[model samples]
Target: MAKPRIFEKPMGVRDFLPEFVSKKKWVEKQVEDCFRSWGYREVITPTLEYFDTVGKASAIEEEKLFKLLDGQGRTLVLRPDQTTPISRVVSTLMKEEPFPIRLCYHSNVFRAQEREAGRNAEFFQSGVELVGDHSPEADAEVVALAVEAMKACGVQNIQVAVGHIRLLNALLEHVVQEPEMIAKLKQSLGRRNLVEFRESVQSLNGSDKKQMVLSLLTMKGGQERLDQLAKMDGGKQVAEEVTHLKAMWHALEDWGVASRVVLDLSLVGSLDYYTGVYFEGYGSEGYYLLSGGRYDRLLEQFDRPASARGFALKTDRLVMASTQGPDHPERVALVYSRNMRYEAFQIANRMRRQGKAVSLFVKESDRSFDSLAGYDRVEEVIGDGNL
Candidate 1:
């Protein structure tokens, strides 16, 4: 006899049983309601796109992109992020539709991750993009929308920390003389490694400029410190950026979301594409739940020169941060014969209409009790003795 063969699921992947499916549906509905409440219309885009298009503003460190060749022998890959595809759609397909397009989406993203991260290769994301407007109000709108989404999840302890790329860029453009030094500084900032950033700055010939850059890194958190940093020498342009940030801060407060907002100048987004204001929502437990920012130049590559802004909430992280006891209450299960399947389903439907969780399973044998016993909070099991 041939040896028996065994098949196993791949690592970092798991099946979603019925209970998990119900939880996922509840979470998705909450996100959808929050987005629609803000007048954001739902939109869908293909999960795969030309590799060149998706690669434009990619910040994925591990390039574990699932790349393949299309029928035309052109490179195509699964989309690692949604913003770029949506930008392409707005620029090419939705051009002449409307200004400041308010669009929302919920979909899966694939990423190649190292084992230590313990994250899935495929995960879900829900976010909204507000394009065609560049104003403090628009920035605040996106941030507020994220806050509302979190609240809709029954999550209360989240803070939105905001920053601006222009603030850092203004300082860099004036301080760094050599192109190589600027690149090194950008990498350091992206990693949030202040020590490396200081060392790289010191390697430069000028002390005054290096010191200024180092000091800027230290001047973080809240508006007062930002104002003080603005007064430093060679910091006038940075000061103007501060003014812009202050305006955005005020707008967030005016929208009544200031209590949930924080100013973290030291905060650096992992992605390099953000060109202006950047913000991330963090759970009270210190987990990053959502992130987004402005990237006006991103769409320029597609010949669409328009102001664009958006943010994405990690569905896995969101679910982890907001999980609670079962969302639905315990209910009765009705077991019946194959001949009574339709009648049992009708009875289950009526109970469901009364807002109950009713499970109708055919009794396979006397062991059905053992199987049903595995389900926690099973209030009662109703069945005929047909078995």
Candidate 2:
């Protein structure tokens, strides 16, 4: 006889039990409700897309993508991010639509992560994109919506750290002239390695520029930090970026979420498409629950350039942080003898119509009454139609 073969799921991938799936679905519904209430209509994009199209709009390296060749030899990839694919859809298909299009989605995104990190190879993301709007109000509106989404998930101790890529780019323009050197400086700052960042700044041409860059790496707080940055020596562009950020801060305050907002100049988004204000929400549990920013140039890649901003919440992380288990709905199991099958089903249907979960069980099978110990109620159907 041949040996039996065992099958297993790939690394960094997960299989959710019923309880976990229930909690995840609950979280998704909450987030989707929040998005819909804000006038964001749901959109669904393909799980696989042309590598060329997705690659052009995103900063994800090719190595991290799960690539495959179709029968016609065309290269395709599992989408690593939702924003790029959605951008392609809007730019090419919905070109004639009205501006400031609001679209939302709940989907699974695939990415390669280190095995030891215990991260999922596939993860759920729920987000919304506000396209064709570049005003400070748009930026503030997205951030405020992110706050509300987190609240809907029952996530507490949330902090949405806001930063402007323009401010960082403006400072770099004054200090670092070499593209490679600028890239290195950004990498160092992104890693929070102040030592490397300081060393890189030391090579700059001017003390004032070096001081400004160093100050920015540590500048994080509330409106006071913005006030201090406004007085820095980053010239015209930096001043404008700072002014824009201050305006966004006021807008966030107007939305009544100023208390949850924090100013963090050192905060840089992982993607390069972000052009202006970017923010990421962190929970007290130390998980990054949400991330978003303005990607004004992203649509240009698809031949329909327009200003856009959005955020994607990590639904798995939110569920893990907020829920203990499935918390399944109130359920009753209706057991029936052979003669009472019809009555048992009728009762089950009636209970279901009354907004209760009912599980039907026939007697003398593998499943016994003991198997229904978890149910809220277990009723035996008698031939006389009485429990």
Candidate 3:
């Protein structure tokens, strides 16, 4: 029989090598510490859920999901986003737990699209959700958590751009009460196209509110610009959301982290679920490092509706932004003599217990100690005698 060819991995997917593992774990630890301190208990959901179940409230368009059949001949698919599965867990599994469930999760998500510099078809995300509350303070807390998480990872030269979905929602309410009009406006917002948006509003005879909305599309930097915007808009919901956004902004100011924030009212999220404040973080590379917002209606689909807000930072991009190519942490090496094979295992276990990176190397017939140079550190010799 002829041998079958071994094809390369599909594009947009990657395998993490040992050198990347150390830094990846370091990033996870930072996120875990930040989330735990904020009272968010960690939870996990399966990597694959029934195609329909995971896609029910997913942000991914139906056409973009990667699907397959399970052993039982049932349709199944990889999760496209973490929050939806987490929401399902809270709603269906832990329904009676309590109000304002503070849950955190770290998982891989898959989609079926060609990834580019700013996009990925498969990626890792770490985030927390605060369910059952809708206060501006809760919103601020989520935003702050994202900022703190990035800072923990040694990330700098980044800005968290904040916006309110309500502002655009309100404008849609005023201009095009038609479903078609709303959908078209959403499409424009997703692309951030000022020209098309202007023509669309003009077609609807939108003058005052349209102009205001268009102006928001151009407000792209700093707090003073956001304050100027808040003073212009007025309406019950618009005014309330503005008040909430300002409060959140001032909270950032109080934390002395306001310099790293930018107000972007036109920053519409691609997800259909975000019904309140929306945000995305960008580094100097001009790429989104993290993206999330308020999805208050997400849990309701699972029959346990509640006000919820949170954000997820893309861990892979985080590694890219925070670690320079040559500076990524190297793997560890543990070398031992023939008589100390068992001791080598003991030492590696002890180092792991103390949260240190470790890899064991038992004495071999051919390779010399010079091979240890490949790793960041090495335990040269386990003494012949035990303590």
Candidate 4:
């Protein structure tokens, strides 16, 4: 490789400035507090895990993982997602704990991203995981919390679309006998490629079943839409899944987040581990803010039999959408002569104790008050005890 310039950083990574970081932290705190209010405690996990464990089990693609070898030559991976590592903790460390554990986290996850405009190799994510609950109520709870979290971040115009994977899977499996072909069509849906999906449908010999499946993306709305779908030819095949979604909708209604939600059968989740109801939240201008779904089979991979559901907010994106950040904390600058250094320290500490951020700068002969542009207030102290 050629010698890199000093200004260059690795592809897909980012450097957040102070202003951006302030907003990011604000968003993270809002989400954490919201998670806590719902009785979900926070937990921390290692950033690196054995490649055979979380690396392979994470919802991220294998090629997108940042893999390396430790001193022992065992392959290790920077965590690409939180779900797998949290599952590992639940199965091992929290094994003795009872079911229905509610945990939340704010962590930096790394996934190898290409030279793309909108992708980040390392980013911040904040979310919660509810384990050992298979009820649609659990699904509804996560969705509702997602709404509340966004509201806490001051992200307006939020729309959360919920879907049942079984409905899509059943319809595809019924029409396309081959699993690979069905997977191909699903890949198209996961990519949100309506044209490609229609093309894939047309390639399936133009059957009535293919046409019905083709309409799944447009099969989105509220109870009336659900009712319409439940009466469709293919919807009857997924009667149980439809019933699950209906129960979830009713639960969300009780939570009062139903107005911010829309039913979209096409949401296959961003991760494959999502085996049941899945959803994604969008901010204004179609910004993908967060995603979560039920992953009942994930905990089983770690030798623990339990159901789990969770969501992760793209913290960086939320920061971008946030119009407000923590004000500069009421800065106060303390200026003093060289002989009054000790007194300046005392005064600065006093101001800090009074809940203001304080900084001390020597009143040098060459210095101007203009140098303290960011300070909200400035006070100069003299050796004679004058302010």
Best candidate, TM-score: 4
* Model 3 pairs in collision: none
| Residue-by-residue lDDT tens digits, candidate 4, 246-341 | 898999999999999998888886637788888999988788999998888888889998989999999988988765567667888889988898
Candidate 1: C-alpha RMSD after superposition: 3.9
lDDT of each residue in 1-387, candidate 3, tens digit only: 655467556656777896577677778888899899889999989888887777867877887788888888988878888888988898888888888789999888998875554456788889988898878778878888888888888786878988888876765665456778777877887888767877876776547656655665677776677576566645566667767778878877777777887888778886477998899887767757898889988888888878998898988878777743234434578777778877777777777787777877777788777867777777655485342
lDDT of 1: 0.78
| Model 1 per-residue lDDT at 327 | 57
Q: After superposing candidate 3, which stretches have Cα over 4 Å from the reference?
A: 1-4, 114-120, 175-182, 198-210, 221-230, 323-387
User: Model 4 reaches what TM-score against the true structure?
Assistant: 0.94
- Candidate 4: how large is its RMSD? 2.0
- Residues 220-276 of candidate 1: C-alpha lDDT, one tens digit per residue: 566576567556554677777777777877887788888888776556686467888
**Better by TM-score, candidate 3 or 1:** 1
TM, every model: 0.86, 0.93, 0.82, 0.94
Q: Write the per-residue lDDT of candidate 2 for residues 185-237, one digit (tens) a residue.
A: 88886777889988988987778768767887678888898888788776899
lDDT of 2 at 341: 86
Ranking by lDDT: 4, 2, 3, 1
- Which segments of model 2 are wrong by more than 4 Å? 1-7, 114-117, 175-180, 202-210, 323-327, 365-368
**Model 1 TM:** 0.86
lDDT of 1 at 134: 86
Alpha-carbon shift of residue 345 in model 4 (angstroms) = 2.0
